[model samples]
Target: MSTTYHAAAVVGCRIPKSKIFLTEKVRECEHNIPESRIKDDEFCAKCGKPLWVTLHKTIPEYNRDMNTLCTFRVFDIEWEDFITVAGPGAVSEVANDCEKPSQLIHLPASDVRKRMERGLEKIGLWDDNEFGIWAILWGS
Candidate 1:
């Protein structure tokens, strides 16, 4: 089976996981900024804290459908280290790094939702929708 690899930078504050707050209602914050304003360097509406933002894009020719098999790994590296290598070329750098592990975690599409729910529950943030769950996970 052919598989695609993907990576995403989860931008958020460096706060404790349990204390992090995420909300999709950006207008509810005191600033009343629209949701579209929630980009890198924007502050959290609920906490009024600054956010770290980075640009990411997928090559149109490499897009994959929801049914595609995929594998990924999350690396918790320093921001300076990440920024130094951040770009389209970074993927090739990672692929060529002999020191890095060759194995990647693979989850079947059928089990994704269930596994995600279990993970969120374990972190006391179950039932959160896409944006909220991702913010909480990355903010912590």
Candidate 2:
């Protein structure tokens, strides 16, 4: 079997995973308006060290013939090429903390499809006539 990478879309809303927030910060330095990329500060909302944010794409779906059907796809904010940002500290000290890391989140197709369906339902986009689930990768 050949392993392939899929780009996930930011649907409905987006949230960071916290582990990679700092990495995104560094990448923002290269951009003019860095605020667009930074979801929030690098510090973890719970712990204060540093946190990463994860963006999730939500799709709407419905049921038909004992099968789930997707209606429409909602695209959220798009993430730039960079990933994390630095936490509190000097530029030199935080510079090294910046690193765009590729994270592999194994989301089963079944679960993914289910979530998409639910997301679509929540947004009133569920369509029983439609079918098939689309794969979305982050930072794609």
Candidate 3:
């Protein structure tokens, strides 16, 4: 069988920008924002805005005929309001600390893909017809 990868839907909501409140927790040059990305609790450095302030829980259902036990976190923000639905091990970090990506690139997919040392396969998104059928039958 061929190795395939499927996307787990990530939805992002655009949060309104406001003045950043800096604490002793995250300090410039000392803190690892560029390395570890932003922790949910960390505030933005530019505007001191947080990347993820609130979380909205969502359950994904393939359809009425099938039952699925899965929860997804979605975000909607400026520049883009889309999230990649990485399958299982593809995003192991999200389940561990809720940081989603242990490493992140807010840039376009092509740019991000270039930086990735791993191979990325397009098994498609949740709304695809073939993916839906497959999900209904074998989804976790």
Candidate 4:
């Protein structure tokens, strides 16, 4: 019932397929179960895939800090890159604020744009100038 906004980006990177997990479609699965109802050992009755998988890694210490923001990164297998779809304005912002040691990989916007264009082409939407693509990709 509430809406929130944050800055995000799509970073091009290669993630091993072994690390990826699949899940069943929510509410539309054969059992009509939500992701919360699925257990780790359980698989979809229709497709035999997980009901859901946790892809984001959260830092527990940051949870206690009111000033700190948590950024979530989602791996887009089709695009072969990491998409920071929610939370902090930037991943570097979170990394800089971390009390522990951390490293940030900053990719140039031009390079990311190239990959994004390729992803759009893969999906049959080749218009790089399209406002909808930009809005959805950048989470605007």
Q: Which predicted model would earn the best TM-score?
A: 4
Positional deviation of residue 20's Cα in model 4 after best superposition, in angstroms: 17
On lDDT, the candidate that comes out on top is: 4
User: For candidate 2, lDDT tens digit of each residue in 1-140?
Assistant: 54433343222212232211222223313233355434666553344544444443322222323222233223222553222111111011111224333333345545544665575456454444443332334332
Order the candidates by TM-score, highest first: 4, 1, 2, 3
User: lDDT of all predictions, in order shown?
Assistant: 0.31, 0.33, 0.29, 0.36
Off by over 4 Å in 1: 1-74, 80-94, 97-105, 131-140
- Best-to-worst ranking by lDDT: 4, 2, 1, 3
Q: Give the TM-score of candidate 1.
A: 0.24
Instruction: Give me the displacement of residue 23 in model 3, in angstroms.
Output: 33
lDDT against true structure, model 1: 0.31
Residues 1-140 of candidate 3: C-alpha lDDT, one tens digit per residue: 54333223321111122211112332433434664665444666666665444533332322113221122222222343332222222222233233343443244543333322121222112232211101100111
Off by over 4 Å in 3: 1-69, 72-78, 92-125, 129-140
Better of 2 and 4 by lDDT: 4
- Compared with the true structure, the alpha-carbon lDDT of candidate 3 equals 0.29
Per residue, candidate 4 scores C-alpha lDDT tens digits across 27-139 of: 32356655565654366866876655555433331222342212233323245332222221213312222244223435555654565455444534334443111112221
lDDT tens digits by residue: candidate 1, 26-140 = 3323554565776543677567765443444432212134211112112333332221111111122122223453232243333544544454455443343331112111221
Q: What is candidate 4's local distance difference test score?
A: 0.36
The alpha-carbon deviation from the true structure for residue 76 of candidate 4, after best TM-score superposition, in angstroms, is 11
